[model samples]
Target chain A: MPELLILVPFTGALLCFLFPGHIRDVIGLLCAVLTFVASIILTGNIYQNGPIRLNLGGWKEPLGIGMCVDGLSVLFIFLTGIVGLLVSLYSVSFFSKANNQSLAKHFWPLWLFLWGSLNSIFFVSDIFNAYVVMELISISAAALAALSGTNASLIAALRYFLLAMAGSMAFLLGVGFLYAQTGTLDMYLLGAVTDGGPLMAMALGLMTVGLIMKTALFPFHFWLPPAHGEAPAPVSAVLSALVIKGSFYLLLRIWCTVFQDTTASPQTATLLGLLGLTGVIWGSYQAIIQNRLKLIIAYSSVGQVGYLFLLFPLVFITLDPAWKIEAWTACVFQTISHGLAKAALFLAAGNLIHATGTENLKSMRNIADRLPMTTFTLALAGVSLMGLPPSGGFVAKWMLLQSILASGQWWLAAAPILGGLLTAAYIFRILSQAFVSDDQISCCGHVSFVMEKSALLLAIFSILIGFRSKEVIFLLSEQVYFVIQGGIIP
Target chain B: MTTLLIYAFTSIILFSIGLFGLVSHPNLIRKIVSLNIMGGGAFLFLISLAYHGRSPDIDPVPQAMVLTGIVVTISATAFALCLTRRIREKTGQCLLEHCPDKPET
Candidate 1:
């Protein structure tokens, strides 16, 4: 099943390259649906039986590549599946328009390749494999970002590509250092063998910095706004929603497992948390000031991402095991909720841009009357971003706040509270334009019903997940136990 | 042992130089070359690690990794070059800092 998760998208990507026009669209959609189904079955299998590990080509670990799916990875796979399918649906209509026909030719292949790489990142059990898969993701995602062919997008893609390449090099050097010290490429083996030595510390520092750069944590986020804001809508949705999460998931996994005991000092974790807090405030402030709708959403991603880094500090500083689990689950919740909300917001912004033929937020005055479905989608997604009640973002922030309070990190509590307010500020900034009555409502194009509904469904799912947090929490706790027991080394 | 130390120091210096060039230069082509230099430093470090032991045979793993790394780096550099060419053609700009910040329509 894990192999199926990778194989389907890759094969579909190859088929997409072979076919042309309508046939390629059908193949891309079919591949997406197949990948989603495989992910569902894979998740269920893990739920019923436990985590599954596959030795590629019947080769044993420490020799050949290994793919493993624990509770954490399965959750990510499921996310990619859900977002990939809807985005695929959205893209089918998105690229069918007259102007986007040239883009459709490249979008299918690159997107499927990206999906395959994302799945592989979640499944790989070795650091070197993670590096390789990350490179694959960076190249494909950069290509997708440049699909719009605008000067801004082209420049953004170049900037993004260069930074990501540098980050990957740092990551590779870290991998080299780890392999030098431990002589093992497998993550579990490295965890078992490593001690709190200078080599381990160096490797940890290098890898963390590399991953942070790739994740676009506050200080390194210069390329994100332009790249994400300038991409075509579906591509923007995917890049904002899923691509960044890929590196983040790897960072979480490596920090918790291989570096958990060796060199993951409390000070370093706290430093990460501090950066995250600043990102929340800084990114939200930037979002509030952006004139363009997509740029606003892009900056909001930087803010929301700050919440994920809070997990490191909360988990590291707390002594109680229960609080640690809460922090872990909270971070994952934040990731998923933010991903869905951000994706929905971008797609909605896309629709608004499409309708008005403008990216300016002020021109969207009276959008409430022009495009009710999309406006509602934006509002619902806004509720999630604001961490309001009965939304996934609310659940994540609530759990995060509880864990922060329980751990006596009173200072850390400011981020979610203050960040939420700032978030609401920007969210309302966009939403407020809906109510303003302007005579010159210049809606130039028609948005297909399918495009609006897909975005709406994604927004609805972001809220719906809030009501069903128990299962996700349960799955995460199970994985946490597996990590604690050191049961995965086999 | 001395050889290993020399190689390691050389790799680090190369990496730092590339990083400096990457940060100081705004020209797209120079940035691309700096990225490759950085990659070269990393690959060299990996190669040096493969020879850290006093055995008759060198470690094959890092060697394999370096080869794969080189392949990935080549493809990435090629892509960067393509984007650079397009940017130059479309807007007649070669420096990243010179690109305009207007929102796409």
Candidate 2:
């Protein structure tokens, strides 16, 4: 099933490349749906049975490539499946327009390739494979960012590619250091054998820095806003929603499993939390000031990413197992909710751009009068982003606050609360434009029903998941045991 | 062991040089070349690790990984070069800073 998860999208990419015109669209959508189904089934299988591991070509681990699907990986896979499908749906109409025909030709293949690589990243069991898959993701994502073929986008893609390449090299070098220390490449094997020596510390530092760079955490996020903001809407949606999460997932996995015992000091985790806190404040502040709609959403991603890192400090500082799980689930919830809401926001921004023929937020004044559905979608997504009641973002932040307070780390709570206020400031800033009565609103293009509704579906899902948080919490705790207990799978 | 340490030190020096070049240079082609140099440094480190043990037969895993790494590096370099060409053709500029800001959509 894991193999199928990776194979289907790759096969679809190949087929999409072979076909042309409308045929590629059909193939792309079909493959997306298939991948989604496979992921659902895979998640169900893991839920029923324990976590499953697959050895490729009938070979054993340490010699053959291994793929593992646990609660954590399945959660991410489910996210990619959900967001990838909706974005693919949006792209169908997005590219069908007269002006986007050239971009459509390259979009399906690159997108499917990216989806395949994201799945592989989540499923990978070794550091070397993670490096390879990450490189694939960087290449495909950079290509997609440049699909608009504009000068700014090309420059953004180049910057993104160069930085990602440097990050990947650093990661590979870390893998070499780990192999030299443990004589094994498998994550679980290395974890069991590692003794928290100087070599292990060096490997951890190198790997963490590399993944942090790729994830675009604060202080290293220079490449993200342009690459995400300047890309076409659907492209921005996927890049913002999924690509950075790919690296974050790897970072979380390695810290939880491979480095769980080695050098996971409270000081190091607190250092991460500090950076994340800065990211939250800085990114939100930047978002509040951005004139372009997409750039606002892109910068917010930098802030939302900050929230994910708070989990490290909260979990690592508290010896209480319950709070550890609370912190863990909070981070995962934040990731999912942010993914959905941010994607919805970008897609709705795309619709606005399509309708008004501009990316500037000022041009959207009084847009609520003309495009009520899109305005509502943006507001609904904004509700989640603001961490309002009965939304996924609220649940995440609430739990995060609970864990922070429970751990007696009251100071750490400032980031979420302040970040939330800043988020509301920006979200309302956009929403207020809807109410302003501008007589000269220039809507030059049409937004297709499918495009608007797809964005709406994601926004609605972001809220709906808040109500059904039990299962996700259950799934996450099951894996938290495996992670915290230091049980190396044999 | 001494030989391994020497090779590892050389690889680190190469990596530092590449990183320096990458940060210091403004030319896109030069940046790409610097990235390849960084990859070379990493691959060299991995290759030297394959010879870490005194046994007659070397560990083949790092060698295999190096081979795969080379393939990935070539493709990325090729893609970067292609983008550079496209940027040159479209904007008549090779440096990232010189390219005009994208007009607001």
Pairs that collide, model 2: A358-B105, A359-B105
Local error of candidate 1 at residue A285 (angstroms): 0.4
lDDT of 1 by residue, A140-227 (tens): 9999999989888998999999999989989998998888788889887777775778888999999999999999999999899999
The whole-model C-alpha lDDT of candidate 2 against the native structure comes to 0.90
lDDT (Cα, tens digit) per residue for candidate 2, span A1-490? 9999899999999999999899999999999999999998988888777688889998898889998888889889998999999999999999999989889989999999999999999999988999999999999999999999888999899999999999999999889888888888988887677478877888888899999998999999999999999899999999999999999999988888788855777888999999999999999999999988999999999999999999888877787888888888999999999999999999999999999888888898878888899999999999999899999999999999999999998878988999999999999989898778777775647799999999999999999889978988877887532466422232
Once fitted onto the true fold, the runs of candidate 1 whose alpha carbons sit more than 4 angstroms away are: A480-490, B101-105
After TM-score superposition, the amount by which residue B65's alpha carbon in candidate 1 deviates from its true location, in angstroms, is 0.3
- Tell me the TM-score of each prediction against the true structure: 0.98, 0.98
lDDT of each: 0.90, 0.90
lDDT of 1: 0.90
Q: Report the CAPRI category for model 1.
A: medium
